[model samples]
Target: MDRNSLIMSLPFRTSSPPLNWSSADCCNWEGIACDPRVAYNNLTNITGAIKILMRCKFLSVVLIGENFFHETIPSDDSIAHSNGFRNVQHLSIIGCHLTGQIPMWLSNLKKLKILRLNHNRITGSIPGWFSTLPRLKHLALTHNHFSGEFPKELCALPALISAQALENDTNTSILPLFSIFGRTIYQYNSVSSLWPGISLRNNSLGGKIPIEIGRLKLIRELDLSNNNFSGNIPSQMSELTNMERLDLSANRLSGEIPISLANLNFLAKFSVANNNLSGPIPSGTQLQTFSPLAYDGNAGLCGSPLPKECTHTVKSNKDKKTQDEKVGGHRIPWFQITVVLGFITGFWGVCSSLVLNCNWRNAYFQFLENLGDQLYVTMAVSWARLLRRLL
Candidate 1:
């Protein structure tokens, strides 16, 4: 088919009425635009793009995502016939159902800035060559079947500001295994405006999160939840001064939740639930304000935000008392028990004696009556004397 016929074959059509292909300038084609120097195509498929680029030679931006192109990416030799694809700055193929590995040919697009291949069936490791894109800023490879260790080199891209690789099969021993990123961390020191972040939630990653991660001072949001990580939270994370949100929940991590974490003043969201962690929850202003659910499932953790109180010493004291009582022959509390028993025995003994002796009871009453008369007489005499003195 000719280029015009091939364009019409795809699902998209011109918003304007049909036009004569022979008489009209192809630049005026709907869904296609060109200035004196550049061409822009919003195509449904890559086929039309190849045809257009071969003729126009000056295309810069390609927006072909959400087009339902379920085929594998074309080989480099097939797509790179001319230099037409080299100047592409922004390439978005999101949710396009594109399958197979990321084409190696992409390395040729040296001017690429934004590469978004999210929500597709693309498999295999993320090629390390992506780090070579000097101008790449946003790299999104989330929600795919890509498996392998996370490419640490991506951390060093001088221009990268954001990278999202969540919901994939990428397996790493731990987050701090930055054999590739160790150098990258130093490279990022001079660049100030970059507020880079990484999201690697819902994977099978295991191991201790390395302390070296603190070097990523520019990172703002980090998520490493729903994995098999085990160990203490690195106190070095306290150095992430710009951290805004951190989620490390649903892992096997154990140890005291680092008190140093309180230093992250900008931390807004924090969680370490469902881990083997123990100790007092950090009492930082931000940590104290988080929901109890953030620290739930960790039975050993305690403090204000959680209902579990930190009473290890109190518990130990009670245990010691029990053990002492057991070893000391279950000694009775004589002071308390004797006082109670003596009062009861003495009260009942006297009452019983008084009830049984009729003669003594009668004498006791008679004696009480006489004592009353004598006391009354004495009081009467005293009152009379006081009155005489007053007169």
Candidate 2:
């Protein structure tokens, strides 16, 4: 078989300068390299790629992106135990049509520095062992079907720089001491070379955001939007001094937003809309910089960003209720009161004229006297006429 036919048989394309199979050294081919060297193969079938990795050794990087490998990753222990990608440092299977939970064999690649399985249909709870990888730096599982609470172990990955699980089925309560389990896992300063970011948006996640997240002072972005999270925005979050973006919108959270959040000098994107939050919005340049939409849908929330004004201070329920009733009572129509007063005044005026004015009293009595006399005279005439007729 010719080299072109063999290359064509594989279910992927190669970029130019095309693979020069005619050359005696296959390593010189496009997307293939050797030196004491690195191999950069991309956009290939998963099963075939695995078959090659199984036989070959000394690979340092394997990138397989945007492929149609629609099969479950082999979970067989024997296959996992095989000598494939043992020396690999970076592995990416992003945008592949891979399904099922992460293969158990992945735990064997102890040298892996980056693992990206994002933008696939992979389901099931994320394995906790992923955090045990000592050299891992970037872990992305975004836009998948992963379920259950976020693994708290992820917070313990000392070398982890960036982790994302956005648009998944992840759910969990973030405890107060969630990542504060003894010694600090992150040793680097806020300006460390690694830009750590955590995204867990658009999921079924619930419970309060852990105050312990402030411990990740080096983290740049933290997103927990569109979930079932409740309670107040943690005041400890102000400790994320290096934070750039923070989103906690569309949740069941209540209580006034913490005034301490004004300390987030680096905060560029902040939102907590569509929540049960109330009270005067915390005042600061950072808080005031956001639009009204950022604080909308929260009827109890008031202040500058919104049109609703805050009046007298109210604490207890009784005071609030009484104030509300007083305001409502003041809204009654003056026209209604005027109509009632006019009716009472007209009635009293006419009655008082008859009682107090002698002319009006005499005139009223004279009419009554005339009416009684006419009735008596008519009765007498009728009796006389009846007697004459009988005679």
Candidate 3:
């Protein structure tokens, strides 16, 4: 099929008319911009993109993922020096055994709408320049080795902060970006590729989650799970009135869950498990509608949905520790009891032999009597001998 026919078969702008094969020249079709340089939507089976791919002046989409090249992402001076994939809208390189940092030249993708590099071995900090991409959306870096605090500016992206909800008609990516065992996180059709959100799950990114994140008012998915993020969740996150899924599990976050989270009426998926979060779960909200396992691994959390009830007389950590110590103090030492039992057994065994056998008792007494007589005779003889010598 011709390039135009292929592009038409996949999702593009909803306004694009149905392909009329009756027409000879595709250029005559409505909304068909015949720009000679615009050869886009490359879905090739190449192992790795060579330098020439970066030089394509009008290539619009690059989706090459799920391969076993074991090679670092290829780069060259063209990407660093000139407009690099300037018109590219979607870029995905997932599960390619890719290593090394994301090339800094990606900042050249001023028009990039979606970026997915999950399931690779990429390391190094997330580039701060990512926030500068005005049209960027739907970033996924899950299952990588990215570390360091997220750039606060990332949470302030104009598209994420105030982008209107996707209408039913907008075109989205032609391929699946996030999948587990062939199950995709989102469906193949009607879901916008430019969904306003981010996922950094299963990385080493640390530091307090940026309070600026609450500004993403229209974001649908926000996942920072299985990282080292700490500190209290921002109460301002409740402002995300349109959020559908929010996961902060397996982090070091402490303090009470923001009671304001109860206001997340649109939240379908939520988890805060395996954190240092404490206190009663906020009452009378959708938070209680979730499974108790959603709140598991937090020792200090209590109340509805959990087996631990919040008590009027709350105990402090010090008090609980002292009570535990007192209980431990009363435990009997088994080693000392064993020693006492051994001593009693030995004493009883000897005493029982003498009492049970008359011969043993008589022999014992006779030996004592003989020893006493011998000692007395020796003393008398010694005294008589001394007296004779004196006379």
Candidate 4:
């Protein structure tokens, strides 16, 4: 098809006709990016025959999301000779009417970083080739009907930082032991890729989480919530020191929480609620710091943070012993005793000084009165003797 006809067929075309498609001037077209140097040469040479498909090599982004492009992507007919979306780094086809299995050819886009295909009716097992995309950092394939055991290869991508594959059910088991006739069979043979952080919540996945998952040391978030997963949370997960969020809620997991989880000091959110777990919750920095709500709904759990305290008789005896030690260790210091004595002595000294001062003042007044009386008597006797002699 001609480039103009193909462009017109795109669901993104608006009612207002695109800028004059009379000539192949991609620079004047909206949503059409072209190499400036190519456009400059084409403008000067006045060559209107150069197709945009040939000139779109310099395209950096292609946004066809939410445009109701209902059809299989990378269809053999549609992608026969075109590399239109080859160089584009971000591909978001969210809520598009697209269907069919995820294309294996999508793994060929080496530069793709973000692939969002959420909220669609897409079905089929997740392609194993997805692990080969080296630059893939964000992937969202939620709200689809994908089936099969979780692809272990996708968890091996080194550059995979965030992945969301929630709300899907694996219709078949990938366990080699369960395959028909004891012949070792590989269900999906694609390259091995590892993702650091992933979400596989609300799926029909049942079985123990693979112990190999702990190898993802850089993983920060892991959500396997609302699944039929059964077994103790792997102690190996303590190696994920960088993990910040962990949600394994609504599972059938049982057993005491692993003490090793306390080693994850960077953990900010931890939830194992709605599980069949029992025994005292692990104690230590990370576990103790979590609110009771994070460990709630486990009927058999008991500890300091939880309302159900430990019921072991030995614990009560230990508490009593510690209390006795504390009480016995409470001894009054000599300095405090000295301080109390000093206060009492100082109070008595002040009272005695007041009484002595009062007594001295009264005695001084009485002595002055006695001396005055004696002086008056001497004066009167002398005056009377002088009067008689004069008479």
Candidate 5:
């Protein structure tokens, strides 16, 4: 393409703005480098529509970071109808302060592999069509204000759970290099090994974390922290055996921490702090290796890592129930014993008095004898009178 063609398609102004479109070679411009296969623009103060970017058929990677643009994600029909940009494999446009929801047109890039749109003002729910992308491996949407329910469709993606591809496979390809924090990344491949799993952190999004999250068995990082999400942490998340970093902090999550999470042997960085989580932290896991702050803000959480202790030293539900039974068994039945002792004392005292006192015993027998004699005399008198009358 001629310099004029490239200039017309350029949407943003770079540090070294092209002074004259008459320039024969784009390589001659400052802050711009071009290999036969790649074009790199070291840009800032960039403005205008980004739709023109989709016109490049050979463009496999579009990594634009910290560059100012017209704030359009290029979702309008004009760009969607364009025939070029069919080979985009890795697209990362981060920290550009771009506004508007993630565009629907991005779905047209059938070959898209890794997508990072974090640190932007993008709004709306994560699109369900994202699951349709067959090659999508990594997605990061942190620090956006996306407000809606967690996209259930995303958890069913098979590519995210597939075995990781070797980084060396992309060595022959031209990868974009960018700076993050204060350090410069040498190559995209070297840093992408930790391409965080579904980083939708720091948003207004609310709702229960779906149980389908556990289906990502091979995922490395899953961060959904700093949102209004409510409900118990899905026990199914324990199925992510390969997970390295898991952060669900600063949410409205409740209930006990899943013991299964403790089985994640590969876990390195983990946190569930500032949530409604309760019960003892699972024992015998790397979760306890984290500082107490990891479990802080959860009033119900207790254990070694946390300062508060459980009411009972229970290892499991069964152990707790057994302890309760033992406690109940040791209780004395004082009321029943008291009643039985009282009854026995009253009966024995009365009988012993009668036996020991001769006068009392004689009176009791004499009263029964006299009553029997009186009854016999009355019966005799009645019989005599009746016999006389008959004669």
Candidate 6:
């Protein structure tokens, strides 16, 4: 087909399609172009629906923002037969009012480097097949209703430089699965589902902090305020060697502050107030830099930044120690003396009772012996008198 015939076959939105077009007129069509690199090649097509398609081989960028193009993007299987845009490297369809799920055919663009589809009502989870795009660098899908867990496969992309996915309440557990520089950041939040590393400031996320979150060594900004997270801050969070901003305010966390958190060398903005946390605040170099507002509204917390000092904790510890020492010092000797005196007194009383009973028995035995001897003598005298009378 000639260049004009090819341009006429392509879909366009107008009252009536153009009918008259000469070979020379093909160069003037709104979306037609000819390859200048080749002396006689007339490759006519559309790009971004605005610029005339000249030199299809050399067409590298396509910007189709705010266009009236209305058609369901074909599936990957159908695009091979539909003669889809083959060579574009960058494609942006922002604010196009496009409807329906992201077509699987978009993955067919092997040369696509950047894809921007923000500010549209695109529904559906990000395609799992996007991992096939090796050269895809920048992906922007913010301000959409794409609901699901943060795709781990996307993070595994070797070429992904920047990724922006915010404002979606995808009901997936994001804490335990999240690993930035081999550290977990949602260690104490019990929320079954979390949007860790994202700006999830205003949402209905409820749960306790995952204890495995102290591993994100490279996280700079963490905004998890205005949620319903509760639990003690994990002491292992001190491992975030490069954390700069942390916001755990307006939640329901409780427990003594971990002393190990003072090891964070780069923490600048920190807040964990409006919760039920108790005990003294953690102290050290980075912790000293936080303002009073960082730990406000927690009535049970006390320390330097807070007006309530931890004298009770110190006093309680000291009192326990003193009581333990006093009990230890007095108990052994007193117990030993009581046991020894009891044994001696019990032996002397038994010996005195035996001696008195023996003396009484001895006197009674002497009196009985003398009475027996007198009875024997009286019986002998009576027998002698009776014998003499008989003689």
lDDT, candidate 2, 74-121, per-residue tens: 576766777676666657676666787788888887666556676677
lDDT-best of 1 and 3: 3
Give the alpha carbon lDDT tens digit for every residue of 211-260 in model 5: 98888776788889999999999999889888888899999999999988
Q: Which of the predicted structures, 1 or 4, would earn the higher TM-score when compared with the native?
A: 4
RMSD of each: 18.7, 18.1, 19.3, 21.1, 12.7, 16.8
User: For model 6, how does the per-residue alpha-carbon lDDT over 278-365 read when each residue is reduced to its tens digit?
Assistant: 8878765567568888889999988887888887634588677666657646633666788999999998776667677987667667
lDDT of 4 by residue, 1-391 (tens): 3555545544355655555544443545666544321211212111112223324554443334444445554445344344554655555555554678786557667666556676566777667777787656556675565656556776665554333321131222121111111375433221112233566566556677767667666677777777777888889888878888888888889998888888888877789989998988876566877788887899998885788987866558867766665655774465788999999999888666767798866776798899999999999999999999999
Candidate 5, residue 291: the lDDT equals: 92
Model 5 ranges off by over 4 Å = 1-49, 164-187, 190-196, 313-391
- The number of the candidate with the highest TM-score is 5
Give per-residue CA lDDT, model 3, range 40-132, as digits (tens).
Answer: 234332222333344455555665676534677655555567655666767777777678888877888776777888888889898878878
Q: Model 3 off-target regions past 4 Å? A: 1-50, 55-58, 164-185, 188-194, 314-391
Which whole-number lDDT from 0 to 100 does residue 389 have in model 1? 100
| TM-score attained by model 2 | 0.56
C-alpha lDDT of candidate 5 relative to the true structure? 0.73
lDDT of 1 by residue, 294-318 (tens): 9999988889788877785555886
Clashes per model (N, Cα, C within 3 A): 0, 1, 0, 7, 0, 22
- Candidate 2 at 366: error in angstroms? 89
Ranking by TM-score: 5, 3, 2, 4, 1, 6
